[model samples]
Target: MNITPKWWHDAVVYQIYPRSYCDSNNDGMGDLRGIISKLDYLKTLGVNVIWLSPVYQSPMDDNGYDISDYQDIAPMFGTMADMDELLAEAKQRDIRIIMDLVVNHTSDEHPWFKEARKSKDNPYRDYYIWRQPNEDGGVPDEMGSVFGGTAWEFDEQTGEYFLHIFSKRQPDLNWENPKVQEEVHKMMNWWIDKGIGGFRLDVIDLIGKEIDKKITGNGPRLHTLIQEMNRATFGDKDVLTVGETWDATPEIAKLYSNPARDEFSMVFQFEHISLTWQHGDKWSPIPLDLPALKRVLTKWQVELADEGWNSLFWNNHDLPRIVSKYGCEGEYRVPSAKMLATTLHMMKGTPYVFQGEEIGMTNVAFPSIDDYRDIETLNFYKVRTENGVSPEDQLAAIHVNSRDNARTPMQWDDSANGGFSDAQPWINVNPNYTHINVAQALDDPNSIFYHYQHLIALRKAMPVIVYGSFEPVFEDHPAVFGYVRANDDVRVLVLSNFTRESVTVDLPESLQAEQVECLISNYTAPSTLAQTVTLQPYESFAVVLPA
Candidate 1:
């Protein structure tokens, strides 16, 4: 398959979870104005695009994911004027802003949902999925919510159960309704016209769910709906569209991202992240299998090398911090963080740097459940406790897997609230912020921030980083992740040690070169690549050789 060059192919994205990013007004939440105030900072960080989490009108259920109004900004996040200012300011810095499009569901407080529940014959009834209860007065199906509990919510007024695959407060939108699709498209076009970049669709795969058939993702009409969506908005424009699809395999990804399909620029697949999920249960944690992780990542790299695109990321608002989950958060935090960045950024994908990730933020272990704010975390606690799980075990799992671990406020300085807000924050800031902050990172030449800056610049300078074909090296190595990216001009050999102990590996004769250019390394640069090389704890580097 022939690849078409696009701007985002070489671009790096920075994701900001709005409420915790920066609180400019001391309102205990980050707003559009706060984001605008940091445009220069983001510009300095070298990210080409900013993928802002949901800032639309919401009741704060699910933070901002359960949107109530599609066109208006939430009061907590500021007004439409603030959003316009952010877009304008980011554009000035050559940074494109992509808002999260959460069409999978809407806050139950939304006008459509409110009216839909008023009476069965309401005109807007079809805007959301509704079904009558079974003969036993039970739910429409045996489906469970992603957060917990039943996916169907009973409405007394309408005498029907509305489908909500997430929080009961978030009713799933009916994509089968042409009017809903039109409304979503119209709203997207409104943002595009405002000069916004594109969209990072939220749980987009669930939009075409066949509820009656118990199919939630990769449904029969999933691609058809996405293609129609592309035609309706951002299809002709030079905009990036990435769909959040937990069920996406290489085959399914091709249907969604292959250029000829006109669906999405790429899809965020969870195969790599799901490696630690034991028996598909996130709360049931297991040791990170380094070899298994390499296999999963290599599969995606090789499978999507030609037709589809990839979204490279380790941390997001919905997942635990990378350093905490996959690296050392203690003594080796700096090197491990840089090592993780070097490994992921060198892959062929549009890499995303979550807020605080550039400076090596780790997961927060809040003492009690009362300190947690994420709906998913709270729900899991309640459900598991009721199921006779010990509170101690649950808290241990929460420390490692809770979404709230990533929702902590950004640590800017050592001052109060980590300089995120003057007053108490909506959630507790990580206590380690005193040392792990932007201020300290800026002062240190060997900080993780500088490492990321160099990596981003490297991506922009080397076409091989973006367009090179990937081939796995040391596929059977226990603790080493090795790969080679090659094109006509150069072959870049990237290697990382995913362990706390020093490991040595022999280089293949094919990868050996007479002359090598050290592109980037987390540790001191070696003079040359010897046949047998020893990598220190969490060490990673990339070197260029003749293709």
Candidate 2:
């Protein structure tokens, strides 16, 4: 963008799931040292930021999300010295590091929670949410955890239930308590002073819940709490903050991300990604409603353009791979991935590239349930089976929608453990890694990796790609999606075929042939415009149009 460098506004963030990125110690788990070993690779990808998933000390109950110690590095990921070295190395390459901040809850193993459960009179009891059992000795509220069952966990010693919206090991923190907020702020400031760039707040919106009403998000004091958080911790620093607001509407998102307010630089909204699920349930798969997806995204693009900003992503540690969910992973894997990247990268926001996304990683179908490691997936399997869902059916759902799908180790080459580790990986590497690995992509000029490099380069070279206003085109079309982004000097048209079948669109008469200049495309086509144009399966093209 022509605007002064606000780093976050124009930067591409590459997310690394520490357990799956690479294993430097041959322990089969990715670590801070593994990330340090790949700094040059990130530099080559042209991404200016790296968002590492939680490396904080944890019990691994919910992977790294259950933080036992926010200040200490998790032994599985490596030492604090390793993290310091990683930060220095990344900075040397002009890449900023954004850490995953899981403050909504802490592991029960945390000193605060450990003491809180000892007795009702314990000094640390107020650090967590504990409630007396209901009249019927049931949960204190009607809310269900995101992982299923009641959101309340009964602690035998205290004879009170603690709220955990995730796993029981992860008890929600009492943000209403000033002491808790102070502890969170102190920890954040310590990280900032340690030279960390920013934070990706985990389940940030859920932190402000009303116990009586059982509302998990957009609670009464959510905005006030975030505002105070900013003023206390990150307000003075030049840092990036992104909150994971799973159920946030556009209006709610604006509140968290508006620049006028000292909350966050942007928020990750889940509306578009949740389109294919029935009744907002990830396990319930249905046909993807393309028009609805476009509508939700367009609303965010329009509503957040002025006051707030958006965090663009298709895959993350908690979701399935992009190609498997939205694109054809079997026959049209390469082109489909490039198409997905072009669509998201060309949007009006900061784009995030999840680990292995650039090289076209696809989801895995582990032959048996034992192959899965994610607690969420395993929990779903147990619950679904008890509810009479057939084993085959449960496996089908997990294969298509498990978070583990995105947790597979990064495939660097075709060698053993996909060159990720000399030992067997914590999770099996996708067998397709032999062909879809980064080494193969680097050697092949037309690989998805190169396409992503081109896309990142275009964002850096063209200001319009970063600052242009977005307007949806062919909003009602099912198989083909199109949009235009324009600035004072240039307007760019992005068109993609979302299906494996050829699709055609009637070009608007306003798009003159003389003004069209090809910028990027997954497949070669004539630059000249026609009244109607056909797109091959999974083809995507972007062109500079007359402004």
Candidate 3:
């Protein structure tokens, strides 16, 4: 059953936010050499693929997402030789490398943009989206940047406005231009030719904008354009390409990830990540909904049952730490984190591990907004501050949910700079490293790190959790969250108590197996009402029964 055709189906992809992972040169920044040094660590985590964030030559306008050059590594990361060494080292460790492909935009400092912005009549002018100002001398659409400010920025040199969905320093590339498309394909092939097996496409859905019609938001163009990419550089390459697509409907997700669709292998969706935000803006919300979380997972469960693949995860570079955002990381940190891991990975899809996630890293609580560095976080703070927003409350909310929440230097150990750097880190290491470092978690058998190892091993050992169809077992029950995954020879029953009080999970008529083996359990709630079993607070159980 060691099939290679479907390696991705059974693969574990670990996402490494390079700047925060490790720094080897004492430059206060993580580099390719640092990643090379940690291949063995990633290998020990049981992940087969490493999805690295952008490492291309850039101005770091958006943390390398705004690529200035597609062909080489940024000076901060290392030279091209260093990248090759890291790639070879990772491959030697049996880990495939997935580079982040930020094709939607290029750095404004890019030679192409520099030349293009010289004049509207330049050959490279059409390489980006440039439009004549409207009758009112304003940008045509009231398009909003995900970061902040107007999506269109006026360029005095060109006497035209250029579109930037992100930072003004990053201009959206015109995918409709054949030359632009060809250049991107060539760049992608160069990476693949350099031995990369896959790509984690950044803002990939934003490619192929509708000409003449201004793109207001996430629409169908995201899908139809990806079709072009799959057809071009990645055609029949036996590779992986995931899109950072938010607000895509379930049907759209299938269209993007369906094997036959030829769009992408999988894409990152943002629906589940929104649960942590419950207030003014989705970013710094006040409340979280656990029951609604189960509902979100349920939709994906049915949406991708036999059609598409889901990228299962809790934390990544964009959102706050999983430990802080999801489960009550303070009160029931151990069981809650453990149960949350069990809750997601055991579902039907490929599991993506964020860096430092295996060690249960939580979000940081900054004493002042001055400590924050993320552009998105700063934009929100500045705008709210200018609007007469309370400086104290804004800083408090930011402490709860800043992108820097996930960007703090990784805690490798309790040593200097959390063992992540020989020099001062670009960002301060979380002060709780003494209590939550990898060294401490790995040493404790019942720690969150160990729980992740158990879940990963079980997923690889049992296809019922990997390839089996996902069916929510106790869907109608409010307190009980359970599911069943049945492969040919195995039926895995996963039941969790998401509530503070114990809840009973009744046995299904088809679940006739009287005996159940407890693969893992954090707590136990009684099921005396149905004469079956109950689960304890924040506890999760994985039982193997007869098919």
Number of the top-ranking candidate, with TM-score as the measure: 1
lDDT of 1 by residue, 1-547 (tens): 8799999999999999999999989989988888888888888889989999999999988998999998999999999988888888888899999989999999999999989999988999999999999999999788999999999999998799999999999999999999999999998999899998899999999998998899899889988999999999999999999999998999899888899989999999999898999999999999899999999999999999998899999999999999999999999999999999999999999999999999999999988999998899999999999999999899999999999888999999999889999989999999999999999999999999999999999999999999999999999898999999999888889999999999999998887767688988988886588788899999999998765
Off by over 4 Å in 3: 1-5, 211-221, 509-513, 523-532
On the 0 to 100 scale, the lDDT of residue 156 in model 3 is: 98
TM-score of each: 0.99, 0.98, 0.94
> Candidate 2, residues 217-292: lDDT per residue as tens digits?
9899988999999999998899999999988888888888877777999999998888888897788878787788
How are the candidates ranked when ordered by TM-score, highest leading?
A: 1, 2, 3
Instruction: Choose 1 or 2, whichever is better by TM-score.
Output: 1
Off by over 4 Å in 1: none
Colliding residue pairs in candidate 2: none
Query: Model 3 residue 319 lDDT?
Result: 81
**lDDT scores of the candidates, listed in order:** 0.93, 0.90, 0.81
Model 1 TM-score (2 dp)? 0.99
